[model samples]
Target: MVDIIGHLGMGLIWLAIVSWLAYDGKTALGFVALGAPFSLLPDIDLWLSKAFQTVNHHGVVHTIVFVAAASIVIGAILAKWVVPRFDGDYLVPPAGSSYVYAIGAVFVGGLSHLFADMLSAPDIAPQVEPFWPFVETKIVTVDVFYYNDPVVNWGLFLSGLALAGVIWWQADDDDSAVAA
Candidate 1:
């Protein structure tokens, strides 16, 4: 699958989770809209280069370790710098905490992105272990899914766009009512 397509798959899945956290329809949908992009960001490392270099060398960005580290850094910045500057309270843990539900949310979102790419990739010169360390081994061939299946890609793409449109329409209506 193309990187964007892979992200879209993960984004839709993440939306389901975010929706569950909301109190109302609009909030639930807004959470989903906000989360879709974050869920896909771990794969931004792919834009760095084709070659892998260290622990992070194995396309470090996609690895659980790398994502966790980056998330901690990001969470810290958001909690420390951004929040205080905006007169909000520190929200995320300043120092890393044991992997909690929130951390798991991030992990699932990021790991899904990696899985999307791995399952669809033809060349795994440095093969990936979907369950690393615990598995500590690489799989030899591609999995059951095709790399760029039209049906799967279109299904996910359409779903995301449709959901986004619904969310936007609701927002626009709310805005119009407020204006009136």
Candidate 2:
């Protein structure tokens, strides 16, 4: 239910923290290629349902099982294939730490999308069944703000930009230290 701006912002914020913690001094900007898109992935159902009618707005893709499965698959691909394939292709390839960063980045990005939709105020329905196929229990129905609200959407987006700036500044310092 969260707008694209808010969802993307949440992903960027998590990408910053995950990269910084997992790969010290890494620039969060580098993760946007992988993370930003995944952050909007859960909403794919919106488009699909419009076409085929099999999916729902807040449906199967919102579940913990779906998120966990995606994380595991993405992690495996990063750890086993993509990282290895890309190694030595770049200016020295990305650091080995990138493999680890990518796994966390994609997972966090995708999960953030679900989190936003869960907490967002629905247009009509009261709640979404995140555990749809398994439990049919609707949760996190707390309405923080209407999805179209400018403050929440723009605020999250701007906040992400500020945090990204901080990450870039820190990374420059780290690079300088390494050079020294």
Candidate 3:
């Protein structure tokens, strides 16, 4: 329910943390670049609802199941087709690790979007049922901010960028120290 900027901010923040924990500098940057688009993936339901009566924003598409399935499919495409086209310097997944890395990145991006929506969706949009079938109830929204709150949205976006910059800077310093 948060705006695109908020969702993207959350995605970047989550991916930055994941990248720092699991990857080195260039790889982390690549992961963020590749996965950030998926942060807006759930919102595809907005368009889908226009075409299909059963689909709706903040409905089944917001569930974990949808995220998982979409991740696998998107990851496979990225691993088999997209990544191969890029040079080793770009998104170089560790040897034989492309599939896992791609899928995990996609999942993280999607989950971040879901989490942001869960925090603010009920205030304006429909309640998000993130667990869906397994848990047939809407998760209680935190209501910390409104969907279109500029301060919160911009704050998250800028915070995410700053955090990512810090992580990248740290990684560069580490690489330099090692090279010394």
**Candidate of highest lDDT:** 3
> Which structure among the candidates has the greatest TM-score?
3
Model 2 TM-score is 0.80
TM-score rank order: 3, 2, 1
lDDT of 3 by residue, 1-180 (tens): 789999999998999989888888767776777788898899999999889988888888898999999999999989887766544633455555788888988999999999999889878688888988898887455777898999989988998888778866775776678689
Cα error of candidate 2 at position 63, Å: 1.5
lDDT of 1 by residue, 61-145 (tens): 6566766776665545444444334222212221233223234445555655666656665533244454554556556335545
Better of 1 and 3 by TM-score: 3
**Cα TM-score of candidate 1:** 0.58
Write model 2 residue lDDT over 46-130, tens digit each, in one string.
Answer: 7888898777767777676776677777766765755455443221224656556566667888877777777684755346666
TM-score of each: 0.58, 0.80, 0.91
lDDT of 3: 0.84
